[model samples]
Target: MGIIDAHHHVWDLSVRDQDWITGPQLAPLRRDFPLSDLEPQARAASVDRTILVQTITVPEETPELLALAAESDLVAGVVGWIDLTASDVAEKLGRLRALPGGEWLRGIRHQVQGEPDPWWLTRPEVLRGLRTVADAELVYEVVALPHQLPAAVSAARHLPELTFVLDHLGKPPIVSGQLKPWSAAVRELASQPNTVCKLSGMVTEADWHEWTVDALRPYADTVLDAFGPQRLMFGSDWPVCTLAAGYAEVVDATGVLLAGLSPDEQAAVWTDTAERVYGADRPNQCRIRRVSPRGDASLD
Candidate 1:
């Protein structure tokens, strides 16, 4: 009946550089995409609430996003960046909690996918910082490449009390059409009671120019099977997914795959699950429309 896009992003071009976008693997994503670009499309598709995920791994980016959240009703929550490797990591997190708009900050993330070490998450310092996330009552957004899944699993196990949201469906290999290692690894992570995966970002991983929903189904199915309906959440990776398809296509294609599921199960994947996990209100949940564009609008 309603939907909460559990994962999405917003970035201002005038600020710091996103160095990851320069590579050939991501050549198609070389433009400035901000919250405005996503607002109109999300409204049309009825994706009411969104978690504004951070695009950069710098400390300053978190506060900037928290400020943005305060100004935008569309932004129901925020997953922000924190340098977990710093010596005083615990203190930093506590300090951030007292900042303005901090209530909108519901989670923390680091670009672990960019780490040189495959076992980065298992490192003592990083694991210590991850524990702080659980201690502070926030979710941890696990954004890792396929190879890094094992370390993610280890970290997740060490901090069993800390809840995790897997980003990009483990960055599956849709473009090459292989699923063995990735699928198996994802199953292991999802087997844990504390982990959940977002059904987002497949467009960028698949054959961008000539991909279809069928191409991404196997990966999405694996995650759905492993995590079940209540733990799974839908996300239109939006402007980022534009590298392959538009906002409407991403939403429509996901709807097609979900067609066979029961109304109750579909409700959780689309809306209820996110609200329960993130403590966020569904966007546009109760609004009334008038006969004309110029006519009155009010709460139903």
Candidate 2:
């Protein structure tokens, strides 16, 4: 089956330092991770297309990602960072779209998880900026912590026109093994037709040295039941996922978590859902050829 990794990131440390990779735990990510480093691993896992997501919240990062996507065969879409609360956010988005390879800009994102205020997404100016994103026909990716999910749900309810893609299942409390508040909050977010969730980043949330597919099953099953496969997409969250598991391991673990679904349902999670949610139109946006499981080649 074809696969579209809906969330992955690449960074060049030589260009600028990643301020977040400060402590010993994140030291592995301090070095540069260009698309050249990721291409082979993704190809080995049969990932036909990928959505290149933003790592840091900087004005220059989006344009850089767009230009990189313009030259890549695997990066089909880009979910870049934007100042959601900027008064001139609309004009800024327009300018980004006009830059080289800007047509690949499918969505916008912010590190809402790092915000001191749990309700940051519900702020008035942020809401206005989100409306502008919708007006531009772009999706908004929410990288929020579990405590911030309520605000994410509130924002989704406030703007039905904008598609909200929840990254990493709102960073569930897998390590602690608690599911009550997170599960309930996820259900509420899925209740909004405009929202979708990514099945990713769970490995790092668990014990990096001892996490099993079963440990991730509870949280995975929670979203599967809440959002259904059509509203859930698979993402390697690569490079970051390498902190806990390899690229193939993440893909295999997700496969096991989704083993109970029908073939069609699995297909939705693997590729179709992402293509629809991220607007990855094969004819116009992506031109990568598909390599079948049995070594046959076909146009994507």
Candidate 3:
């Protein structure tokens, strides 16, 4: 079956500075990373489809991403950004859906990790916005820190109709190797039937220069035990992961981490789960390359 990269990002520097790339450490991503730059790598990895996630919170970016999805062969779905707190959020979502190529708008995300308040997601207004998102049948991507996971769990509990995808496995503290609080909180969020977690961005969370598959295994296993393969999906996190490992290397490491699972479970992480979560069954624009059970290394 063809693999699906459930999450990744693209940004054009000329359009607007990704201001978050301010620090010297993020210098590698200062240059423009257009979809053209990612296509070859994605194709090389046998990734037939990808869900393009939002990078910045600006309103214009979503439409631009939707348009890009309409043009690109690789991107099958888009998790764009929206002002979730807006009073007319439902109407705004309708307007977005009416935009060119807007049908690919499968989900919405915000940079909740940067929010100073851990309870921001559980706030009254945000919950209202999430209700609108659910009514429109769009998923809400939870880009939150470990401390903010409780609010995510509460929000999910409040609005069970809205599917919540926890980005970066709630960003466990791999570099520090501390897992307890994060693991427990993550399990709480996973306990919600409407929630899912991405097995992405772990490499960057570990020591950028010196991370091993062994170093990430415990955190990965934590989520595997908590959410199971069906509720977990694969994501490359692409350019962000480039800060630590290359796309193929990330895929390879994931393969090693999941080697203990049966072929069917491995398939869920690599293909089936993403397809099911992101609704990627729509007619795809990209040329697909199938991978047999023995050919999994091609993704690595």
TM-score pick, better of 1 and 3: 3
- Candidate 1: tens digits of C-alpha lDDT, residues 39-147: 8889899987898888887788888888877788888888888888677767887777667767777888888898999999999988888877777767888999999
Off by over 4 Å in 2: 282-300
Give the per-residue lDDT of model 2 (tens digit) for 188-250: 998877788899999999988899999999999999998888888999998999889999999
| 107 Cα displacement, candidate 1 (Å) | 0.6
| RMSD of every prediction | 8.4, 5.8, 5.9
Per-model C-alpha lDDT, please?
Answer: 0.80, 0.87, 0.85
Candidate 1 accuracy as TM-score: 0.90
lDDT score for residue 160 of model 3: 70
Q: Model 3 — which ten-residue stretch has the worst lDDT?
A: 291-300
The TM-scores, one per candidate, come to 0.90, 0.93, 0.93
In candidate 2, where is summed lDDT lowest over 10 consecutive residues? 287-296
**Model 3 pairs in collision:** none
Error of 1 at 212 (Å): 0.9
